[model samples]
Target: MTSGLVSPKRPRNLAERLVGEFTREIRQARLRPGDRLPTEAQVVRRFGVSRTVVREALSQLQAAGLVETRHGIGTFVTMNRRDSGLRADAAEIATVVDLLAMLEMRIGVESEAAAIAARRRTDEHLERMRAALDEFERLLGAGETTEPADFRFHSTIAAATGNRYFASFMGSLGTKAIPRAHLKLPDLPSLHHRDYLASVNREHEDIFNAIAREDADGARAAMRTHIGNGRERLKLRQESSDNLEPRRKK
Candidate 1:
């Protein structure tokens, strides 16, 4: 059953978009737990994406434990037999905890990614990272959201790792990888917001500089610190809010 799963939009992030559509079907029970998914050919025709894109999308699904592909048969949903929703849930990133968990996962994957990027980055990779960093700064100055620029900056580092899978995995996480987009900590005082963004930009600079200088240990440390600080920032914000409430009540 097609279920109108097709999209006419030009291919931008085809695999991740397809993953979203498939997830909607599964969550809504349009495609139930054990039902077999459409064939690769059918998916290609419906989505107007290449076979390779379809395969990649399916591979992500398989990796998420949402579906299983047989040697010659077809891909089947694997949701109910196991806690298959974890991957889809992650991709959705619906809650604060989910976003925090995504950050933790990035800390594990991207700390090493930064180290490799530092060792492997070429002039071109450095240039791309610089461009992303510049754009982030420009957007931040304009009082605009920096989520896309932030994502590109991190993804550029992943690309510098000389591993397409690293980039692909980051791509699979999509824009949700930007914690600010998913988080709504009570607004810092205006000056505090400025300081916070400045600090964040400084962290970005540290990572970029380490990569440009080909300092693997520095890159890894910078990346770990950046993500770890973000986690703590949120945790502390939550704790402070909780502490303030009883005083306000009093």
Candidate 2:
């Protein structure tokens, strides 16, 4: 009999059954470190599936960091290597998918940072925040890109929070594209009839007001509300686009 890795009577999709077989073999130590898996063809034969299905199964194992495939060779079990490639671009790609992943993170971090900065920002830090905010306003009004200024504003808040790590992570994100502008009440001719930006304005003002009043909790709450509002707007925009446009010419 084969390894009998799984009960032949298992109830699941073929891909799932393959995962189970691979996992069982791994757990039973039948598949050891550096063990090269049989070729995709062998898997096709064993699993009674096409090459495509075998590839999908191996892909799942690869995602789990349990196996790796060499271009010219075959798939092999990973002894100890961590899964670095699976989510390497998740943070970046999430922007396109969710439109709010970054803002959600900001709400969690910057909102609390706003609270801390309200209580702890030094004179210099306050000056920097003011400067950054001013630049943000200028760029936004000048019809120029405000992405950099927006980052500066958040970075200043992180600095004022008096936590170096906070600032560090915020800066780390700076290297990634910020989705704030995309989520902005876009300059859609359709949406321009009403004051869609009013909510956005209020949210920013609330955050600024909290900072001005040196109210910690208010700043945090305001920031969260602002981010949450943006997320909602993004959803609305996506929903509106669902059937609004005619099919594009191929």
Question: Backbone collision count in every prediction?
Answer: 0, 0
| TM-score of every model versus the real structure | 0.62, 0.53
| Candidate lDDT (C-alpha), each | 0.70, 0.59
Query: How many Å off is the CA of 105 in candidate 1?
Result: 1.8
C-alpha lDDT of residue 225 in model 2: 85
Model 1 scores a TM of 0.62
The residue pairs that clash in candidate 1, if any, are none
Candidate 2: residue 123 lDDT (0-100): 70
Model 1 poorest 10 in a row by lDDT: 1-10
**Residue by residue across 29-62, what tens digits does model 1's lDDT show?**
8988779999989999999987656755665555
Candidate number of the best TM-score: 1
